[model samples]
Target: MKACIYPGSFDPITKGHMDIIGRARNLFPKVFVGVLNNPAKRNLFSVDKRIEMIRRAAAGMDGVEVVAFDGLLVELMKKLDCRIIIRGLRTGTDLELEQQLSVINGKLLPGAETVALLSKPETYFISSSAVRELIEFRADISDYVPKEVADMINGGNAK
Candidate 1:
């Protein structure tokens, strides 16, 4: 079966990321949403919490699974037998960075390929950093993130 791995820190799982995942699900037979734990980045939610949030967001999506992992993403792709890596591009910078990452991943795993999807124009401006900024100001995050994430950031029942 054709499978793809979508990897990201997913610190809080934004709506923009979900949009890409929904589209990718339609394209691939099986899609694994891999929550990456980045040591260098400070996250409001722990890795396990992020995984649970993503899992709730992805519930009822057939052939979709939310998982967590550390270390090189290329290795996870190999372990999962994911030939395609799904990446979301929000701007020119995202494209450039994805290109660089794709090249590096390609070198690390010659069998892997990266497929990028541009974020929907309406959600193009949405990002994890932007979400965090909004949260800090107590701005409504319901529209920017899934209900679970919104609840978490808004001091409601998220778990």
Candidate 2:
């Protein structure tokens, strides 16, 4: 079966990220949303929390599962027996960074490839960092994230 890996910190899964996940699912038979666990990075939520949030956000989706990993993303892709890496591009800077990473991944692994998908117009302006910032200031984020995620962000009950 063809598989794709969509790896990210996912400090908090934003609506934009969900959009990419939804789109990736339609293309690849199996789409694994790999959440990166990097201690050095100042992530707002724990890896487990991030994974839970993703699971909650992806509750209704089939053939889409969330997993956590550390170290090189290509390694995780290989571990999952996937060759395609899904990335969401929302800006020029993202393109540049993604290009460099794609080149590096290609060199590191012969068969690995990166697929960049432009965000849907509605979610083009949304990002996890932006959502975190909004939450930090106690701004309403109902539209930027899933309701379960929003509740979790506000320290309220979340299923």
Question: TM-scores of the models, in the given order?
Answer: 0.93, 0.95
Q: Which consecutive 10 residues in model 2 have the weakest lDDT in total? A: 150-159
Candidate 2 residue 73 Cα shift, in angstroms, is: 0.6
Among these predicted structures, which one has the highest TM-score?
Answer: 2
Ten-residue region with minimum lDDT total, candidate 1 = 150-159
lDDT of each: 0.86, 0.90
Candidate 2 residue lDDT tens string, 1-159: 999999999878999999999999999888999999998898888899899999999999999989999999888887888889999999999999999999999998789999999988899999889988887788999999988898787775422
RMSD of each: 1.6, 1.7
- Candidate 2 residues lying further than 4 Å off, grouped into runs, are 157-159
> Runs in model 1 with CA error above 4 Å?
155-159
Candidate 1 per-residue lDDT, tens place, 20-97, comes to 889999999899999988888788778888888888788878888887888999888888888799999988998999
